[model samples]
Target: MFGCIAAGRLVQTNLQQVDVNKYVFELSDPQSINHLVVFLLGTIPFEPGYAATVHLLWPNKDWQLLGGLSNEKPSAIFRIGGGKNNIMMNQPTATLGISIEPIETVQQLLSTLSSGVMKSGGSNLQHAVSMTEVGQMASRVIENLFNYVTSFAVQDLPMNGIALGEVTERGYLPVKAFQTWYNNLSRKLANDPNYLSSEKSA
Candidate 1:
């Protein structure tokens, strides 16, 4: 199953089936999004022998193959925007694509991916699949996990009124198990987006 989270919003359910074996998520607030996390919900796997590929499309920009996820590793995250390294869009919208195809497709895409920045959308998207599992609950959960630190983006912090101890105990940690690791990373970046780079430079 495929799912995505952008700034606390569950977007996988909102994906539009734009073409055969192709699904698109319409991002309403591109700037507010710091990262886009795509994942499989839980136990389901691609019908044996197939995989799902993630791609991004920015108008007037070449289609970029973000990466591909298979049953072996069901989730992958992409820093599409908001990072110092990703595109800073002046426009209000961007599209995220989840492609379904045979296992061989990823190998071919990787060849293009290693060679340079963009791949031909014509050849890459031409392949087709019979189905794709769109992440419903798990997608949102995973997105929220990576996105918790940016919780301050909306308006106010979610656990604002409550005491810190109670908030941490009752509702914070397992947000919204993948939480265990991303929580730490999200907090670190939230405190300093370039913390890792800063460390390496040190």
Candidate 2:
């Protein structure tokens, strides 16, 4: 269940747990979306005694994994795309994939990708680039109204920081994971007032 209070309007989300491991959110039109936030609440299970990892997949095949969701820490709320890596939005197809797995497995999987131990599955990465051939561009003009909210939530300070320490101390940290965290945190800090104020005050 999710609720957002904006401009005196109450928007509520009521989702049924029909599936134990998968959930999908579809946005037909993404032009109006400048920011997105995600929250997970409940007794989230881990992967066979290992720390859990969440994967975020996009229509263009862009994917990111987030770790540290388990029975001990059952609640997670995050501002997506605010960190070093902004959210990927607006393509021909609009679908988001969210799933949970183990942190170690996720690291090894990505490592294999870089070490060339794992080969690309028939150039799937190349196909993602060809998606923009259908002319999907826009130009805009006119007056705009903006209502700014001064207060915002701060968590996961180092952009996937939680998983970084877990993986590094466990053994080797995945380069992709570190980059994801670093960039996402950079982006998030850029957007966050708390970080901005602290910098200015310093």
Candidate 3:
């Protein structure tokens, strides 16, 4: 009944029944991914009264509503990358919780999801698709969004010397990674200046 497209590969998710109406699934590598597209498979659409609410597990353990999908509308897009969505993970994967319980749930899904994901304000990347076109425009949408890479709300360091390691998500590395790299190059040049004349790690 549900499907997810992450990093251009498609997966037919197996929804494990937790409660009578609640189901859960794992979304792998949400940190490295730029977007996540969730959709109803349309094999068993909602029966007019019942609907599904999609939720992404927050870092603090709260289930925040990612979006929802139903019979009329079956697909939605989520900006899960390093922008305003800023979804950081302790490990590599994330948990996706879906609840197909109430009409209030359906309304909540459609309230923000709308017919399409991009609703003006910013540069519109992908247009919303029709019911028949469910889950088809995901790649195109991602491609369009890729063109506007500079527009994303990425975190930036205001000044220099912000000590950061490889694990830090934001790009404020004050040492190592870059400093160590350049420092090593400078030290090599200062020491020998002909270090590159010899074979190095290949």
Candidate 4:
């Protein structure tokens, strides 16, 4: 059995509007699902810390957290049972996954930013100006946020199979793990001006 749940929250604006959508899905089967595959399609904006949790109902009950793919399209696969004779017996046994697809929200956000900049005549300017300064500051904030999240993900990623299995049992790493690593990495990077300059140049 496979089912999907979708929900969204709408935010209204004078110039543009946004809707944040979240999808939660589940799959269950009496006959063991051996080679299961999931594909996340489209260019939907993904939420930070989002993950897909898969549980196996078989001889050895275990759970796995699907990691994100670096490509534009993301997919994951898992092997459940070992032998053909092994069957999934547990009733209502399910694997749950959540996908955060922020489609309209991102478009609206970009539109709003563009409109604001155009209205302020920022686009007309050719050189560094006050508006350029503000734009650079905003870009830095966004870049910092992206770097922080990526660093956290890298540090929190399981170093070994045992650690990965532990994450499957625990659902996800604690928020503190991400926060601690993010802060530490951010501080280290901030303190290294040469590294920062090189990164910026790159």
Per-residue lDDT of candidate 3, residues 12-126 (tens digit)? 3456778888777776656666666776653577766666777887556677676565564566666666333555744466777878866664564445655545221211123
TM-score of each: 0.55, 0.33, 0.50, 0.27
Write down the lDDT of every candidate, Cα atoms only.
0.57, 0.32, 0.54, 0.34
Model 3: ten consecutive residues of lowest lDDT = 118-127
As for TM-score, the candidate ahead, 2 or 3, is 3
RMSD of each: 10.9, 16.6, 17.9, 19.3
* Highest-scoring model, TM-score: 1
Global lDDT for candidate 3? 0.54
Residue 46 displacement in candidate 1 (angstroms): 0.5
Residue clash pairs of candidate 4: none
Per-residue lDDT of model 1, residues 50-148, tens digit only: 777888877677877877777755765566656343564575787888888886776577556633332223333221111122222233345445445
Candidate 2 lDDT tens digits, 1-81:
221111111111333233565454553333333333333422235445433333445555666543223333332332234
Better of 1 and 3 by TM-score: 1
Over 4 Å off, model 4: 1-23, 45-63, 66-73, 82-87, 99-202
Q: Is candidate 1 or 2 superior in lDDT?
A: 1
Clash totals for all candidate models: 2, 10, 0, 0
- lDDT-sorted candidate list, best first: 1, 3, 4, 2
